[model samples]
Target: MLLERILRFFIVLIMAIVGGTLFELAVPTANAYFTAPLWHEEIAVLGLSPAGLLCILCGTALGGMIGYPLAPFVTGWLRRLSLWVEAQLGKMPTRDVIAGAMGLFIGLIIARLLGDAFFTIPIVGDYIPIVFSIVLGYLGVHIMVRKQQELAEVFDFIPRFFRDMPRVREARVAPQAPAAVRDGQTDRQYKLLDTSVIIDGRIADICETGFLEGTLLIPVFVLEELQHIADSADSLKRVRGRRGLDILQKIRKESRMKVEITEADFEEIAEVDSKLLQLAQEVGGKIITNDFNLNKVAQLRGVSVLNINALSNAVKPVAIPGDLMTVQIVRPGKEHGQGLAYLDDGTMIVVDGGYRCMNEVVSVEVTSALQTAAGRMIFAKLTR
Candidate 1:
């Protein structure tokens, strides 16, 4: 194929030369231009005999012969210059045809205006045209090379170009997330479960509702923490640890949401909550849990957090203070006069003056509702 292309190129070159020569012979202006010998009258060293004209024509043909070997080198150089500029400048073509044309024009003007004066000079006069051509062409090539770096000036142009183009209006659309990322726009969130909530077993309900859309990454450190609790001599700790493992399994098996058990433990930070924050940033994912301290830490670190307790509180029936409700007084509060009850969603109902109703259901009138990151706490009074 390459040989055929070379043959075709030579065929075209020969045809052009022959056609141009014939055209010049047929046209009066062209015939005068070609018949007028270049550098023939200027050279007086060769005698003005018929032999001198023959000698001048022979010299010109010899120069052409010398340049024949250089044709491939020149062709390859031009091709590389064009291809390299295309690679560098991308969409905006970097070819400086204006500069090159200017260069050739400058060369011709200098050669014509100073041709006689330069010829009057000694030995260097003979080389003046060649030297001028080289200098002008080099200047043009230098300008073109420098223009290649003009992209540095337009570094800001990149983002603006993308913005101005109509085709990329949805540039911000999140790349198709994995199929498991179907947490319902819940901020690609993860909800960390505290030992208590995992034991409470309501996290599985939240996952089942598909309210959470991000990869459920259970930090390996958290599992170790759970393991530490489970190994404790205390029965409650062991039960909670086993419950967390069970919840983890349910999340894995029943849900399309990705459940990743990442072994990211920060031993240097003694608190597991600190480790969770670090891992959240590493994964670029939100933290999910019921621990209030963990929630705060994640927030301060700029990591998103989903609190199961917060979700539970949000979904709870809004009971404004001054509303009366019936609840069983489950336990005594911190103060001697205080008794505590719980709503079905686990919101604490602190009942004042209801110690007598301990272990029994009674009517309590709501007072002030205290809301915190932990959850909503309802303060009430025994009116029964």
Candidate 2:
């Protein structure tokens, strides 16, 4: 609102200036066309010559009056148009936008050199340069944006060059103590928590165990997402969202690990997962998540990710083939005559031929164990 008012004030000032200039021009034109016929003799008006002070006073007053009423609407329209353009630009990925700008600059440089060669042609020569510049600039931006990833690879040499540069020798000075040593060992790796890991609620327990180190960085946008979910009309979603918030509070109050909520945001990225990935890259930190798809995406983007599910799978008690264990068949599995049970660590155990023993404890012989993206599944047969 303050910005809008400031813009309106400037718009009014500019309009008043323009209106004054127009009126000043109109007075002289009117005198040349109509003043001689309308007045028999030159008369002093407003205590000065009619064409002098009177004209100036009337033009200035009329201009200010006309400009005062129109500024608000014009400034409001301009503000809205600027906001719309900014939103459109924000939707584009940062890398693509940078690549396109670089390409456009290079294209214009080439076009200017080519245009100079065509300067001697004729009337067509005058327009050919402009047409070439427009066409080449468009093509350059389009192609560069499309191939932005490959261009990134090509530019890897820039960093390599700086790394290879020789350093100048100087008198040695004592190194200052590291920030971690001075801060009571509180400085640790920043582990950015994702919404999935938060909702899973195991992170709070892990933090309590002191197995996890470093400050847990929670972005404000992630909290907003949890709030959105907590307010959802769906009961399951609301429960999960509230559970995530509860886990966050528990970690902050009870856990030994340092927890920090960050307000950093990427206005350009709409997806929370993408924003998280970008944040991880910016902070040179690891992403903590249980989302399989997000894990894959982060890995593809060369960002470090610590998947809670993977960690759980790695630490769960190993169930080898032919091992005998007792489990209660709580439900039937997708396959016929197969019953499903869960181990203490939540590993799925498919008990063969135990469907008839539902809700009953039975000794089962493990047949095989399969590790998948979701988690580990153990297949077993009911012991005879």
Candidate 3:
């Protein structure tokens, strides 16, 4: 990261010099070119020439000073912007270390081969070679990234191939423990799941979709909560509880990756939310939740969260207003004359005047969808 900042500083410095020169030239000036005329009789300051190394050093220092404060904000925004791209492209360790090295070499070869012919054209001809340099640099970076991923995969395969190798093979095996109290579990590597996500049950699908990459963890407390909810008096809650258990079973049986249910707990913490956040801190794990309040609370407490609801919404097949669908009104909602239903993903469908359609699948046009931290909800009216 320090290296990243230093590189950015130099980049900004070069850009500043070029940009300042262009701005200086764009308007009519006595001298079309930059650099103060050496013929002038201006005296030196403190025995240092104005355009000397001292001046250059001072100029570089000034540029750095200007960039320091702005860099953090810019870099933060860049990080967020890069997230979408990075998630899609994934990180290339080799590319990160040596972006576009090979492409640059090839570009250099091509430029030398092309000689001055590429630059001899009229008007914008001189810029063609420069543009090609940029393109080649980008290609190199992409190639490096691909190489890094391939390298990582190859390394992984080597281990997998020897995983079953006999006698004195493989490193020490840490006995598997429940996720909550698993020995040697680092804070950042292992995220603990709360009861809400499990009972909500969308995470099972999320795991199956490859959206979730890390270990999908469940604390023993969470399992207990599921069992408790499954035993609830309310039929709806009970059904949801049972469904969550079923989902867990399916994840373990069918998912390609791990679904760890740990026995660790926050013995001192009373609330489940507090315990979750504490566990996340202890293990350096990001929480996965569909609950908006929990997501906000986790962030406030400095714990990372992979919000299942947000992920679901971000990846949802964009549904526009006026799109019609058939839904069954499940129950009466909070407001008078309001009714509620649900989509397959458990997204709430609040149909105004749907009270009459209770327990029945009726056709309705989507009037609107409100996405709150708690969950996503759709508002609709009867169409048939």
Q: Which candidate achieves the best TM-score against the true structure?
A: 2
Give residue 349's error in model 3 in angstroms.
8.6
**Candidate 3 to truth, TM:** 0.40
TM-score of each: 0.43, 0.50, 0.40
> lDDT per residue, candidate 2, 1-384, as tens digits?
888778777766776677667666666532333344335233432233456545666666776677678777887789889999789789875566788898899889889899999978988889888988999899889988877656755787688566534321211121122223223343368899999899999998898898988888888889999999999999999999999999998787567887767767788899999999987776667999989899889999999999888888899898889899999999999988989999987899998898999999999999999988778999999887
Residue 226's lDDT in candidate 3: 86
- Greater lDDT among 1 and 3 belongs to 3
Instruction: Please report the candidate that would top lDDT against the real structure.
Output: 2
lDDT of 3 by residue, 1-384 (tens): 986687577667765565445444444333223345554324332333434434455555665566666666777787788888767545533335554555567666666556467777888787877777677666765675456545555777877566534422222242224323343546425656777887777777667776666677777777887898899999998999998999888677546557666666667778888877876776778888777788889888999988866776776555579999888899998988788988887788888889977899898889898877666778888886
Q: For candidate 1, lDDT tens digit of each residue in 43-76? A: 3334343344454445545545544565566557
Q: Write the candidate numbers in order of decreasing lDDT.
A: 2, 3, 1
Report, for every candidate in turn, its global Cα lDDT versus the true structure.
Answer: 0.65, 0.80, 0.69
Model 2 residue 158 distance off true place after TM-score fit, in angstroms: 44
Q: Is candidate 1 or candidate 2 better by TM-score?
A: 2
Better of 1 and 3 by TM-score: 1
Judged by TM-score relative to the true structure, which candidate is superior, 2 or 3?
Answer: 2
